[model samples]
Target: MNVAGARENVGSLVVHQSGIQCFNCKEFEHFAKECRKPKRVKDSAYHKEKMLLCKQAEQGVPLQAEQYDWLADTDEDIDEHELEAHYSYMGKIQEVPTADTCTNSEPLE
Candidate 1:
């Protein structure tokens, strides 16, 4: 789709990184956008990245540490290792006694 813009969209440009692999051609050293090979049928799941890793293996590229959706990278993995901590914090907050909590009290001797 043609998006009207001043000159071009800067974020769309992917920088060249030797470790980056293309999902389209399953080739290393390029973005899928720069891939010259015909696109394979893209999948909604990570099946493509898995195949991409196979290519990475043949080319001696180390497996990617994590397969992150480029668009959602910022929001994803927010509680990856901290889910328990987050749940404990919420539980502690729920246990807190508010000002309205009734308490049994008598005049202290």
Candidate 2:
């Protein structure tokens, strides 16, 4: 084996410094563990999976048999009041105002 050729071969090999990667934004430099960015809000698919899990559990399915718990894997800590406010806002946007909900008495002239 030629020693000079071996040195050239080793020099050609490029090495990259591996740092933390964020799963939320799929970016490097910052890790998902220490990520300060807003949590990726769960989409419809997430809710669908949760609903399926609930249905399965209600039917006496073995939840422990699963290798991973998708719901429990999240690192986000949801405040009870914040969750309630979110649901309350959603309710306000979704609820249709009926005659009972209307408190205005006099008609606009």
Candidate 3:
């Protein structure tokens, strides 16, 4: 082969080898064994992708909703404490811990 043709072939081989990605940092053109940069730590993006991926263990299992029709049962009576707790959690502020914590600065006449 001509010198120019041989050089071209060698150049192509280098280009092909450079396409390999580094296992350490995930960048192209170098292998992990030859990596000069610091080892990469998993970032939020990596965690996000991990969270988004469905695990094999949950795939075949059917999702159960035993309380899906909870509203259908109306015969159950809500106790006063339960009602009050639910109301408080739903954001109807009935009372404050102290007068100073209350938004009303004026004294009650």
Give the candidate number with the greatest lDDT. Answer: 2
Q: Rank candidates, TM-score, best first.
A: 2, 1, 3
Evaluate model 2: give its lDDT. Answer: 0.51
Residues 1-109, model 2: lDDT tens digits: 2533322233778323144345445566444445688765654444445556666788878764221344355547876765565555444444445789768876533
lDDT of 3 by residue, 22-69 (tens): 645777655555679875544444333222332322454332121112
lDDT of each: 0.49, 0.51, 0.43
User: Number of the top candidate by TM-score?
Assistant: 2
Report the C-alpha lDDT of model 1 over 19-107, residue by residue, as the tens digit: 67665566766666566887555332333344444556778876543342322233345654444554444444334455587474543
Steric clash count of candidate 1? 0
- Cα deviation at 41, candidate 1, in Å, is 2.5
Give lDDT: candidate 2, residue 3. 35
**Candidate 1 off by > 4 Å:** 1-16, 43-109
Clashes per candidate, residues 3 or more apart or on different chains = 0, 0, 0
